[model samples]
Target: MTSTPISKISSGVSRRNFLRTGAIGGFLLATGSATAMLTGCAKSVPASDRLFLREQDVVVLTALIPIVLADALPTGEARAAAVTRTLAAIDGFVGNTSPAVMDQLYQLFDLLSLPPARVAAAGLWSDWPNASEKDLLAFLTRWQHSSVGLFRAGYAGLVKIITAGWYLLPESWPAIGYVAPVRVV
Candidate 1:
């Protein structure tokens, strides 16, 4: 396989992955082939992949950012590196870092925002040991009610995120049974 500049991003990908990552305007997606990604599945990172957005998802994410930040598109090209870092953290943990997947995920987020992703991600966070599960679920339910789109996007986006992110991990496989409530329904 051809070499990539970033390790955290490339190290996790697999042959199954068809992910890409870059700015919406200048995104560079390569899934072992320089094919156009406007259409087609780009090959499934994993058919039953769940809870992560892959490189292609990054397309959605990067594009969404321009929309999200239309009011304030980060000064001097820094583009809030922290946001990338935060995404990287979650992406690393979730493990879907394909270039295409990354772009798609960014579009998903750009369409929404931190509040929405965080809200959808609540399920992941809700299982915290210290907090009262009752209160958390209650809050999650309420949060769910408020941001159905956010919740949906989060789950969908996360699925793409993890799939592309884990494209390269040696022992990795698509996660199963991570059913996001209402996501299926």
Candidate 2:
């Protein structure tokens, strides 16, 4: 038995493929660990009447989280300015919301700057490759409403993903008051 040389390994696996597979593997591991952290996911947010998410939504959601938490938003004035430039970034996560979800989301925003559902929306906001600062803001505004419809339909699944990540990595919590409620007249 012998180990392959580094150059030989590179020849067999294209660097691009290697990176992609490694990312996917890490994703799966994180998802598994998050699920394990929750112990019983369905039991956590037991709003019995709420609609459930499709499997695809759940997968996209749980996976999006670590990356979101992992990416540090630029600090200080730069971040504050970015927030205004993107309409406070909530524009992306608050779109086409059901009246019910819209109202609830508004409340949630008032409370917390980045609730789990909005985190999923923020994930979608960055889906495009090399999205421009303007394009990024646009994406954040337009698609943020997606999960709102899902929420209005009674699927509170986003809550589970959020709490799962929070529990798995306590340190991932943001320094900002993303969850603090604001009073509107």
Candidate 3:
């Protein structure tokens, strides 16, 4: 019987190590591809046109508002109008905020705009238009209920902004049963 030397018997790298390396490489490749695809898919927003929120930012918010508001959001054309008005309100509010706050919002929006980041952070893989109400609600619930502080903060921040912006619209007041204060001459 011939005995094979230990060095020659097996390769230096174990199967586990090989798999680990492959997995890391695969992840990097996938991430890069997703980034490229997302970048290509992004609509170019003119710098001058953006006051506080970019087009992508609006997309994220519009997709999320209905889910965040759920039953509170009206149906059909009213919902469409509400989304538009609320987005405008959010834009105005964002513009008025301090530069630091605005920067944070921009960062968050940019992060969400990336496909991989959106999937990892928001648990959303498809475009907002393609996402179902159930999926959106699930994502929100996960973030809200997550053990991580960052996820909790993300949930709180999004909910606060969407709800606040929506309620700020005069049309939304009646829905929420908030009567406007009487004005004295």
User: Evaluated with lDDT, which candidate comes out highest?
Assistant: 3
Tens-place lDDT digits, model 1, residues 1-185: 97654544745643333232122112312321123233334343521343354554444444333333333334555555523533454546544356675555444433223233323334333223333546444543543453334444455554444344333332222333333345453
* Candidate 2 structure lDDT: 0.37
For each candidate, how many residue pairs have backbone atoms clashing (under 3 Å)? 70, 20, 0
Q: Between candidates 1 and 3, which one is better according to TM-score? A: 3
The TM-scores of all predictions, comma-separated, are 0.25, 0.21, 0.72
Residue 44, candidate 3: C-alpha displacement in angstroms: 12
C-alpha lDDT values of all predictions: 0.40, 0.37, 0.74
Off by over 4 Å in 1: 1-52, 69-73, 80-83, 93-185
Q: Write the per-residue lDDT of candidate 3 for residues 164-185, one digit (tens) a residue.
A: 8888888779987999999999
Instruction: Estimate candidate 2's RMSD in Å.
Output: 17.7
> By TM-score, is 1 or 2 better?
1
The alpha-carbon deviation from the true structure for residue 154 of candidate 3, after best TM-score superposition, in angstroms, is 0.8
Question: Which regions of candidate 2 fall more than 4 Å away from where they truly are?
Answer: 1-127, 146-167, 173-185
Winning model by TM-score? 3
In candidate 3, how many Å is residue 65 off?
0.7
